[model samples]
Target: MRKLQFPVIFALFCGMVACNGKSGNDSTPSSEENIKKEEVKIRKPVDQAGYDVLLQYIANDDTTGLWPVPDQPLPLEGAVLPYNRIVAYYGNLYSKNMGVLGEYPPDEVWRRLDKEVEAWKAADPNTPVLPAIHYIAVVAQGNAMKDGKWRFRMPAHQIDSALAIAKMRKALVFLDVQVGLSTVEEEIPQLEKYLLMPHVHLGIDPEFSMKDGTPPGKKIGTYDAKEINFCSEYLAELVRKNNLPPKILVIHRFTKGMLTNYKDIRLRPEVQIVINMDGFGRPELKYSTYERFIRPKPVQFTGFKLFYKNDVKQFPHHMLAPEELMKLRPRPVYIQYQ
Candidate 1:
């Protein structure tokens, strides 16, 4: 969970962030086979299937036919997008207000997560719902306390705890980052030990990436395509070096300024990119935010975020049901709850 007062903006693997410290292939040989099948579908000259999925995401209304993301590189085997939906619970262990992942004890968290996963499974029966834990590895701060980065890194033990929790159900783990005044180039490598594992993916939050020395939470931040490409290229190198499945890169947004030059963000077979719309508000407001920021822009995959508290804090205060979200244009393949 993250700051939502801005109320606008938008941003993997389904199960590849699998338990047992492996890619999706650890015990599921079939997943590789499925990727071969996906390859065939992905390589069609016209890419009609990809276009069709885009239509479904947008409720089949791409009259202009602009957004079936042309020439997307066929993902490496064990990739998780465009086939399965990843249902992730996001937060930091140090703050319950961050998200559901740390809001309760691990048992209660899993219980709630299981129920949510089931709902997604039933709502979009065609796309398998894979559970995941999206933990905040780098947290933004209100003040530039030390070195003026205005960010804090979680200790190794806490990240270990997240991995341990994900292993409980063979779930995926995504280490999210809020760079604050820091740069992705500077912050991401610190987590290389965990990221080297097959199941651990990456998320970079632009909302907290301040370039002008402003502290996070006071004002929103931004990331250009150049910076994002750095992350993609970095992950691609890891995937190639480790010979692991494709890595997922999640970018969070609710406003247009949070992400810029999206057209310049490169796509790679070694990585699956998800642009998740993570603002907290009523259904209509959230839907508008998605439409304003996520729908028109072309990305490899799309995601929707729901806020348990902020979404339901006011009038017509209720979270968007899984059933309702399925109706979104270019239907979201990723769902996050905070």
Candidate 2:
């Protein structure tokens, strides 16, 4: 009798190698691998009537955080839950705390993302695909340009992998870009390749923009309507030239000063912009911030975000109801759980 055992590496390799494969490969996988390999049955889609609930939440602004971990078993109560409709914003691509995407091989990030998309689709077939594009800080290292030429600092392989995943899943991708010492206009041309993709979108980090010089300790410069519109106009033209759907332009603002000229930001009819109140730390500020700044933005699609363990502690109150938030006018389209 031959007692047999499959190695962990070999098991995962098989999972990727085949469209389908039988599990249980491991003489004794390390704790990490065991966690990563934990499997859960992908549930069937929720009822059709639930679609109305999803849409209503999107219109009204109801949402809760959904955090995906590479390892660990998901709760048995893994039921399909409803969240905000508009968009999702991901964070920590460049946070020194979170390793740069460059640190991992390109395909890995997207592979994880692919698994996430599959899970969402299984739980709710109609779930609109809204993935995130992040780590613009690694691109051009805060300058938004290199040697007077617009170039992305992130490895091309990473971007390619992300794009491939988005294309395959038909998911919307936001190309997050940080304007270090430069203006938003300067970063537009460099982002064209990504913007052209149907699933691709754009995100601007105004917190990284500095006045005298580069920003400090995750804090940077601010942006105004002038810079935002310049980039929007350029993207609007590009989207029309390609006969693609309206592009989603995202701006991260925490405080009033971050967007000094928000009143002047005249969003073009052709393009759609989302103002995300992206201040880290406080949760009480989330509602008020969204009410003050984002409510006023002309763009219909607005955004909100929650940190997995971080923000949850501050706001233990739970998910915000859509009917309550939407009445403010200019409803939010996206809710992010990072």
Candidate 3:
């Protein structure tokens, strides 16, 4: 529940609208033709059908063509995004400060969570909103544990407990890992059993990924494209072998350093990556943070994280509502309340 800092960023640019073009058979492409350059990154045989679905899912205003990144590979079998919106409660069962999932009693948590999902559904009537339990499977610690890694794994029984709770609401389960001093390479394999399940997914917290041997809270952490791609490829293999639905990978970020090499993050048929705006603050502060980190770089999907406690500590003494978030240029499909 440490309140990470968001850098002071200026919202510099506005979403560009598609412009009309003149075709007079000029050898050089017109400014209108070059407009797609900023919107679409890499060009590939686009899945026009699914891409159209992505546009709708984001509630994309025609102003920006960035929501449907041009070359995303088609998902196999059951893909969640563009078809459904996710409302997740994030935390570890042991720590109440981490998020809402652990702040209240089990029955109360489910009751509140169901109401949140309903709110999102009411906000966007066309999309089916499902609940998700994003449990912190690996927690970053101030002290180096027995393995000399500044982290500890939650008990398997606790994860089983999370699965049990998910079953109560038929919610999706996400195992989030904050790999303190240890590498994700060492951590991810340990959770393969749970991840192989059809409904379970993965989340990696870069804010706790201290690669320089510094303690987790000493400074913000980071994840490069190399590490991110590894996670996607790993999940893709799981989907291929087990014939399961596309796995959703959530990456937490508030500052630019929390995630790097945005252009290199690949889009796979079996894995969908969501760059979650994890910063918490007043409405203006949170919106600036989102535009700074998420908008400039378009990932496969997008997510917005709200804090029940941290958010209310500011001026308005309130949390960002579903209606307010929907106004984002590329609306977030995944909503996590901590």
Candidate 4:
């Protein structure tokens, strides 16, 4: 782990500024049908000379730091992560009970999210913190729809709203899909347009991906490695075809049953996989769950989710600190506050 030099920092800042400029209008289309008609201009890869300079600086620098370096092992040797640390706000814009993301208006949400990001930055100054919006693009429902999917597909307007927020913050966006009674094959391709955006990523929640046609929230659902692999392959292909940087694919899990056949999930340079610990409980209970369910499984990267209300209800004292979470075997690169 090492801190990025001033030159590297400047390069990244310039790249981000350019990216923001390219992100045209913030206004969303009027309807979901029209959203498909609006084409997304593919992003070009980072300047090779600048990327090479940053890599050379990282390789030459020997300063130790409290956080891992972004792209430490290099893309050639299994490293695909773009940020040293990621802090995200998770939930849909419609439901406050779901998470903090929806608990406040857009301005307030950004304010709260920035507070968390600042905390992480202060805790680990060496690592660059990437702000993120983990939008619940598709929500599982108790009732079965006409298609019997038992899920509510978020309209493109909602997705665009999240993207607009992310653009304002110059942060990354993740569209989370809960495929109740539906297959990943059916859900993922629907978000292909958003996934093509440079800063937008993807997340699949196994806890709601009921393979048995059961309604969500009644019983824990499951996703096989085959399903996870499909997402990775799809994202990888997107990276290749668009000549963009690697895409991150987040998989939400808190129990063994949430993700089946984990051993068979494939990893590629074009796609970074994050096995996110998504359960909320007492601090000890949550840590134990992470150790048992997430620690044992070696994934490309790791993520942890914290519920602002649920976690505090059980703990009654305090939330897990960044230092405490960093003590895990493989430190989580992505953290979400729900």
Name the candidate that leads on lDDT.
Answer: 3
Residue 48 displacement in candidate 2 (angstroms): 26
* TM-score for each candidate, following the candidate numbering: 0.83, 0.59, 0.84, 0.77
For candidate 3, what is the TM-score? 0.84
Q: What is candidate 1's lDDT per residue for 1-338, written digit by digit as tens?
A: 35572333321344435532355455555656677876664321224566446445544455545455667777776777766789999999999879987779899999999999999989877778899999999999877867888999999999999999999999999999999889999999999999999889999999999988777888889999999999999998988777778889999989999999999999998898999998998888999998999988877788899989999987898899999988777778889999
The worst-scoring run of ten residues by lDDT in candidate 3 lies at: 10-19
Which regions of candidate 4 fall more than 4 Å away from where they truly are? 1-82
Give per-residue lDDT, candidate 3, residue 303.
95
Per-residue lDDT of model 2, residues 162-184, tens digit only:
55544654556677776566566
lDDT of 4: 0.79
Query: For candidate 2, what is the TM-score?
Result: 0.59
Q: Candidate 4 residues 1-338, lDDT tens each?
A: 23658778878886675555543434533344365454343333445454445443322232333123343333422233543678999999999888887888889989998988998888767668989999999899989989988989899998999898888789999999999998889989999999998788999999998877678998999989999999999998988787667788999999999988887888776777888999888789889988788767765567888877778785455678787776665667789999
Please give the distance, in angstroms, between residue 118's alpha carbon in candidate 3 and its true position after superposition: 0.9
